[model samples]
Target: MERTLSVLAAYIQPSPYGAEGVSLNHGLHFTGGEPFLNVDLLLKGIELARKFGIPSLFVETNAFWCRDDDDTRSTMRQLKDAGLQGMLVSVNPFILETVPFERTFRAIQIGSEIFDQKLMVYQTDYFMQFSRLGITDRLPLQEYVSRVGLEEATSRIELLPIGRTAYTLGEWYQHYPATTFFRGTCRAELQRNYHNHWDNYGNILPGFCAGIALGNVLEQPRIYEEGLDLEVYPILRILLDTGVRGLCAYAQKRFGYQEREAGYISQCHLCLDIRTHIVRQAQEFRELRPVEFYTQLGRDVPADQD
Candidate 1:
C-alpha cells in the first residue's frame, strides 16, 4: 500500500482543478468504504502524503464515527497534527438511509471548528435540505423520496448509475437497450488524469469505474510510465477501442453473458453488469479485479478467493 502511494505521488502532477472544489484531480485524497473505519491506517496515509509532499491532502468520510463531542475533537486534532489538510464529509439520501443524521451533523459542526474553511461538505446543498427538513436521525431513502417527491430527490443526489445502484434504483430511472449506452470508446475515461483511484489491493481504478482495473500497481509498478500492453489487458483494450457495447459482445461470445431483459440505466450500468457476470464465471481477466466486489454485490463464486 505504501509503495503504491509513493509511486502514484511521483506521477500525479498538479492540475488546474486543484483550485476548484474537492475533485480528486487535485491530489492525494484518502477515501473509502469509510476512511474513519481504520483510524491508524488513515493517519499513516495522511502522514505519508505529507512526507511525500503530496498536495491538497485530505480524507473523506461518511461521519459514522462521530459518536460524541470528545471523540470527534480528539480524532480531528490528531489528524490535523498528523498533517491532514482538510476533510470531506459525505452526505446524501443513500448515506442518510443507514448513517444517523446526528453523526453527520456532529462531524460538520466539529469539522468546521477544527478545519475551518478547509473542511468541505460534499453536496452542502443536501446538508441544508436535510437540516431544513428537520431530519434528526436515520431516514429511509424511499421515505425521503416520498417526503420530497421523486424529481426533487433525484435532483439532490450526485448519483452515478453503476454498481448496485443500477440494480437497486433501476425502478426510478429510464432503462434502455445495452447498445443505447454505447456512446463512444472508453479510452478517454480510462486514460484521464482525474479522479483515479489506487486501492489497497493495488488495482488502479480509473474514473471511479470500480471493479474494473486498468492494471495493478503492485504487480506492474511501471504501468504509469511504460503504459499498458493491449495484449496484457484485453478487457481494458476492448473498452478502450469499442466501448461497453464491444465488451457486451465479447462477454456474450466468450462467457455466454446475456444482457438483462430489463435493460440498463447507463453505459456504466451495462459495463458493471457485464464485468460482474465475467467475475462470476471465474475466467481470469486481469481487468476484472478485486473479485470481492462481485461477492459483496450478492453474486455467487467459488470458495477460495483473493
Candidate 2:
C-alpha cells in the first residue's frame, strides 16, 4: 500500500489543462467492492495517503455495514480523523437490492453532517427517486423496476454496458456481433492517465479497466517510468494495435475461442467475454492479472451469453 501510494504521489502533478481537466482531478480515492468492510485497512490507507501528502483523499462505499447511528458516526469520524477529505455513499438500485435503503439513507444523512459538502451521493437521481418511494428496507431491482416502469428506470440509470451488467442487463440493450465494434484501437483507453486505479495487489488498472493489469507496482515498480512498451506486453500491444477485434482473432486462433452468436452490447463487453475465456482456459497473460476478476464474473454468469 505504501509503495503504491509513494509512486502515485510522485507521479501525479497539478493539471496543466486548467478548466478542461476538471473531471480528471488528481486524487487518491479508496473504492472497492466496498471499502467500509475493513475499517482498519481503510483508516490505514487514509493515513498513508495523508503521510505522503496525497490531496483530496476520499472513500466510496455502499454503506452495507452502516447498521446504526453510533457505529456509522464513529466510523465516519474515524476516517475523517485519519485524513479522509470526503466520502461518497453509493445510492443506486443495484446496491439497494442487497443493502437496505435505510442504511444508505443513514450513511448519506450522517455523512452529510460529518463531511458536509465533501459527502457526495454518486447518483443523486436514484437517491431522490428512492427517497420518494419511501422504501426503508432492501428491495429487489426487479421490484423497483416493476414499480417505476422499465423504460423510466433504464433511462434514469447510468448503467455501464460492461462487466456483469453486460450479461445480467443484456436484454435491455441491442446486441451486435463481435465484428461490429472493430472500428477503433484501444490505444486511447489503455494509455489513459486519469481516473486509473491501482488494485490491492499493486496491479495498475488503466482507465478503470478492471481485470486488465498494465503492470504491478510490486513487481515492476518503474514499468511506466519511460512510458508503455508494446513489446513488453504482447497482449496489450494487440489490444492497442487492433482493438478487441484483434484480440478476438488471436484468441480464436490460439485458444479455439468462439464469439457469442447472441452478440455483445459494447466493445468492452466483447473484450471482457474474450478475456474471460482466456482466463478460464488457463492461458498465462501477464497483462491479464487478478484472474479472480474473471473467475468471479464467470461464477456470477457465463460471459459469452447475452
Candidate 3:
C-alpha cells in the first residue's frame, strides 16, 4: 500500500473518477451527494492511505463547489504535501450543477496552487433517475409548483467533476453481493436472504437503504432462516486474497465499519445521512484496512450538490 501511494503521489493528487475511479485493485467506489463538503474528513482519508500506503484512492462527489472552494483548494494542497495519490472524478451533470470543463479551466487559470484535474469516468444514471424513471418523476416532487420548481431547476446543474469516494464504497455497493445472494424479487425473499446473515439493523443505518429494507417488507415477501449468516469474513478473505481494496468497513479496528444489508436509495431512507456516516468513518477511523479487499464501485454518483 505504501509503495502504491508513494509512486502515485509523486505524479499529482489522486483523481478517483474516469480511469482513476475504475480500480484494478479493489474496484471499490465511494459515492456521495457532496463528498467534498467534508474536506477535512476527506483529506484525513487520503492521508491515512498515504500513511499506510494504499494504492489508488477513489472518492465520488456530486458537488464541484468543493474543488471550486478555497478550503478544498487547501485540502488538495495538503494531500499533495501528505503524499496521497489516485482520485476519480465523476462527471455527471445532473448531480454536479457544474461541468468538468469549468473546474479544469479554473484550475489552469488559478495557477500552481491548484491540484491536477483529470477526467476518469462519466455517468448517465442520475439523469435517468431524475427524468421520468424515478419515484420523484411520478411523485410529489413532480407536482411541485412549476414556477418554484423552475427556479430550483435553474439554480442546480451538473457541470462539475468530483471524487468517487464521496460516499462509503463498500456499504453502498454491496447490492451486487446481496442481490446475488437474494435472487428472488419478493420482499420475503430479500428478507430471508438478509436474515440468514447474522447482523441486525441499526438505528443510524444508512437512510438510503433503510427505506428500501422497510419498503421491501411491503414490496417483496420472503425470509431466510434465522440461524444462518452471510460469510462476511470468509468471503472477505477470498476478496483480499485475490487483491481487492476500497473505502469501507470490511476490516478495521480503529474505525467502526459494518457490512450491513443494502437497500436502494429509492426504497431506503437516509440518503444524506449515509454520506455523513462515511465521512465519520473516514474521520474517527482508528484501525487500518488493507486496500486489496475492496470491491464494488462505479461511475454512478450524484453529480449535483447534496
Candidate 4:
C-alpha cells in the first residue's frame, strides 16, 4: 500500500476526468480467483484504502459464496461498512454452471439494498453464451435478463480474445479477414493512464489484458521517475504502431512464432498467441510479468485433471 501510494504521488497527474465528482484520482479495486474467497482480507484492504483517503473502493466477485440470502446480506454489510463503494457481480454462463443463478439474484437483491445504483452486473459477451451453451436465437433476451433482474440499460462487457478465451471460445466466433483484423486500436491503453492494476505480488500492469508490466510497486521511486516508456517495451510499441499482424510478423522473425492456418479471431487472439509463444521459449520475456495472465487457458480444464 505504501509503495503504490508513493508511485501514484510521484508519477500520476490529474486528468480532465479527475474533476471533483467525475472520478477518483486514485482508486483501489480487488479482483481475482475470487475476492470473496477471502472476505476478511478483502475487508481489510478496503479499510486500508479508506484510511489512505482513497475515494473509490470496488470489488469484483463471482458471488459463489452468495449461496444463502442471510449469509450474503451479512457479508455485504461488513464490506459496505469497510468503505466498499460498489460491487460488480459476475452473472454469466461460466459461473452459472457451478453457482446457481438464484444465488447471484439474491446477491443483487441484497446489494441493491446497500449500494443502490452502485451495484452492477457484468457479463462477458452475452451472445457468445448462446453459442457455447447451444441456446437458440429464438430464446428471448428478456428470458435471461429476467433471471438476473438486470435491465437492458445495464453495461455489457466484451470478452477479450486473450488467454483461454482465445484458444477455446475464439474458435467458435467467425473470424474477420486478415486485413481487417489488425486495424483496431487498443482503446484501453490510450484512455486511462492514471490508474493501473496491481497484482497480489505488486506487479503493475498497464491494463488487465495488456501483458506489458510497467514495473513492480516495490521499486517505486525508480520506476516512477523513469515512468513507463512504450518505446522501451518493444511489443507494446509495435502493437500501437502496426497492430496485431505486425506483432505476428515480429514474433515469427525474432522468436520463430507459428500461426494457425485458420488465422485469428481478433487482434488480441494473435497478440496473446505471440506472447504465449515468447514467454514459453525465453526467460527474458518474463519481464512481461504475471506469466499466468498470458499462459492460463480459462475454465475449460481437462476432465482428467485432479
Query: When superposed on Cα atoms, how far off is each prediction in RMSD?
Result: 3.6, 2.8, 16.1, 6.7
Evaluate candidate 2 by giving its C-alpha RMSD to the native, one decimal.
2.8
How do all the candidates rank in terms of TM-score, highest first?
Answer: 2, 1, 4, 3
Pairwise TM-score winner, candidates 2 and 3:
2
lDDT tens readout by residue for model 2, 102-183: 9999999999999887788878899999999999999998998899998888797787888888888889799998889998
Task: For model 1, state the Cα shift of residue 185 in Å.
Answer: 1.2
Tens-digit lDDT track for model 1 on 75-156? 9999999988788899898899888999999999999998887788987888999999999899998899899998888776
Cα lDDT of model 4 by residue, 102-131, tens digit: 666677779889888667667635534434
Stretches of candidate 3 off by over 4 Å are 1-30, 66-74, 96-119, 124-306
The order of the candidates by lDDT, greatest first, is 2, 1, 4, 3
Each model's lDDT comes to 0.82, 0.83, 0.34, 0.63
Question: What's the C-alpha lDDT at position 17 in model 3?
Answer: 49
Model 1 bad stretches (over 4 Å): 14-24, 299-306
Highest lDDT scorer: 2
Higher-lDDT candidate of 2 and 3: 2
Tens-digit lDDT track of model 3 for 1-306: 233333323323222444233342232233444556676766765675656544455555543544465755665566556644434444332333344334533333332334344223344343332333222212232243242354443345442111232233323222332123222222332233211111012111111121112211111122211222224223223222321122232333333534334432221212222333343345322111111111122234332223
Instruction: List candidate 2 segments past 4 Å from native.
Output: 13-25, 303-306
